[model samples]
Structure formats: C-alpha cells, structure tokens
Target: MLQLNGCAAGSSSLRLAKDIAENNRGARVLVACVELTIVAFRGPEEDYLHTLVGQASFGDGAGAVIVGADAGVHYPAERPLFEMVSASQTVVPGTDHVLTMRITEAGLDGHILRRELVPVAAENVERCLSDAFGQLGVGVEWNDLFWTVHPGLRAILDHIDKALRLEPGKLAASRTVLREYGNMLGATIIFVLDEQRRRMEEDGEGGEWGVMMGFGPGFTIETMVLHATSNLRKK
Candidate 1:
C-alpha cells in the first residue's frame, strides 16, 4: 500500500501503476485515491480568508483506475480508454513555500502563494512539456492534442490556456469538474480524466494524443502523455 498525501497523489499513483504493470507481465495494479478535505475544515478565525478560500474550493472525492499491460489478453471484458504513453515530473526551483499543507492542532492548515502560483506554472510548463515530447522523438503542436489539467484554481487553468495558446474547449472537462465538484485535491485529476473521456465519446472531440498535468506542493508538475486507446483499436 503506497500512501501519498498531496495533490499529486493521483498522478503519482498512475505513473507507479504503469511501471509496475510493465515490469510484471501479468499483474494488474489498482490505483485508487480518496480525499476527505471536509474532515480538516476549520471554523472562521484569524486568517479568515485562508479558511474561506479553502472551504470554498476543497471538497471530498474518490476515484480509481485499473492499470495493466496487454489489453484484453487476460480480461477480454476490460476495455481501455486512455493509454499512458509517458510520464515525467519536474519541480520548480526555490518554490518550497508556494503551496504547502501541514497538520495543526486544530486540523489541516495550508498556505498558497496564490498570485505566484499561476505565473510559475505558466512560465515553466512549455519547457517541461517540450522536454517530455522531445524525448519521444516527436514535435507537437499544443492545439493538436487533448489536455487533462488539474484544475486546482481557475486562474491556473486560465493562465495555462493562454500560455499554451490552446484552442477553445480544450479544457472544458477540467472546468466542468471544477464547477461541479470544486477541487478534491489529488482525486480531482482522475475526475478530469473521466470527464474528458465522456466528452470525447459524446462529442467525438479530441485528438488521438493527449496530455495529463497535475500540480501540487513543491510547485511540482506531474505530466503524463496519453494516447486514445480507441484509436489504436480501430487500426
């Protein structure tokens, strides 16, 4: 049982599960994440704005996905949705103070340098993604691929959209999840993926290639390149 306590927990699990499945030929890994942010709620007090923002955005949620190699080899009933093509993580230097959570006498307490968060992510994301794609020996245009971004804050999504110059509706799933469920910390990314899948099926939107991004403490960025499995099956 691996325990990760941060917004990147779900992304971390997906990367680890893929590695485990690749190593063990016939093994299947279950990646599950649950967050109970409400349990850490604090009543209004000093730093009232912090309390208010946290209460307004954070919520309880759980999500799970099964990972394995050789689709339909053992479980013919199992159908794959997204294929984990590649995963990488990068931490912006000297950003330890940006987003942090700690256990306090009252409950969970966290700090976010809100103004700096969006800029840090926007400035570094292109470089980070370029490296990931470069290693795969491919050149990619931002608008040609789908995106599943961690919607930790509306501003983060807005800035990333502008930075990447992504087409409209590229982040619709992320926005929808945030609107419907707020930020459920680590579980939020999984919810975004599910919503993305639904939109692709319902609207026949998105390309065969995609990227999943998650941000958390340390100003970390977890990136996973994805391929639509349905496209592969059709070939």
Candidate 2:
C-alpha cells in the first residue's frame, strides 16, 4: 500500500494512481486518504498557539477515489468525473518552517508559522502555476480555470485570490469544504474535489479546464491539471 502524509498526500496519490493506471493496462488503483489529527493532539503545551491552531483546524477524515484508464471498457457502470491531465510537485525555498509536523517522544508535534504561510504561498504560486502550464507547452490564464486549492487557512486562500486575480467564486468549493469539515489533512482535497463536482453538475459554475492544488509541510505544493468530462455535468 502506498502511503503519504500531510496535505499534499491526496494530490500525490492522484499523480501516482494516474501513472500506475496508464502504465499497466486494465489496472485499477484505489487511492485512499485518511487523517486523524486527534492522534497528534497534545495537552497543555508551551506552544499554546500551535496546540490551539491544531485543535481548531485539524479534524479526522477519510476519502477515496478509484483511478483507471479506459473507463468505459474496464468499468462500464462507473462514470468518470475529472480527467487528470498532468501533475507537478514543487517545494518553496527556505520556508520549510512555515508548516511542519513531526513524531516525537511526546507523540506528535508541529508548528505553523501563520504569518509566513500566506505571504510565501502568494509570492510563489503564480510562478509555480506558470511553470507547470509552461511545461505543457500552453499558456493558461488563472481566471479561466476552475480551482480546487487546499484550504490550509482562510488567509492563504485570500492571499492566493488576490495574487492570482481570480474571479469571484472560483474557490468556493475549497472554502465550503473548509467551513464544513475543517482541514482533513490530505483527505481535504478529496472533499474539495467532490464539492467542485457538485457545483459543476448542479450549477454549471466552472469551465472545462481546472487546477487542483494541495499544500503541506515543507511548504510543499502539488498541482494537477484536470479536464472535466461529461460525467462532471448533467445532460
């Protein structure tokens, strides 16, 4: 079983699942993400802010998706949602302390340098998206694509919105997921994806092209380009 940790885990699984499915004909990969932040909870710590933030923001959650090629042929009843086009992972330089978690004798310990998180993400995300799309030999406008950004913090989302000059409601799904479920760690992205699917199907709120972004400790970022298929919208 392939395993990963932190917020970027779900996106990383998507990338790996796509590779496995495409490489092995008829192979289906099931990617499951589960996080129990309670396990890491510590009582009465010196870093009260850290503990409080963790308690306030982190939650236990799980999400799963089946990835495969030749969807109609291999799984006739299964309707495909988003088509994974391309994916890339990038680490922001010299900002590893922005968000971090580790296993210690005291169980789990972590820190969130709240002030640095938003600014660093805002500064680097535009270039990161550009580089990712540039590698595909295409130019994409930020506003034209649907976004499923990891809701690490409301401020982070706001900074990204301002930085990218995104249109209103582009990040509604992410925000909604955060409000409803807090941060489910890596599994949070799946909730955001499902919410996006609902919006697309029910409201026709987004376009054909989309981007899924996940951020985690080490200031790690995961970007995946997605194409909405017919199943994503109602006929």
Model 1 TM: 0.93
Q: Write the per-residue lDDT of candidate 2 for residues 1-235, one digit (tens) a residue.
A: 5333578888888889999999999999999888888866767756453566677678999999999898889778988899998988889889888888776566676788889888998888888888888888877788988899989889999999999998888899999999999888899999999999989888877577889998888788888988889877455
RMSD of 1: 2.0
Candidate 1 has its poorest 10 consecutive residues by lDDT at: 226-235
Cand. 2 TM to true fold: 0.93
TM-score for each prediction?
0.93, 0.93
Model 1 misplacement above 4 A? 1-4, 45-49, 231-235
Clashing residue pairs found in predicted model 2: none
lDDT of 2 at 149: 90
Task: Give residue 91's lDDT in candidate 2 (0 to 100).
Answer: 91
Q: Number of clashing pairs, model 2?
A: 0
In candidate 2, position 2 carries an lDDT of: 39
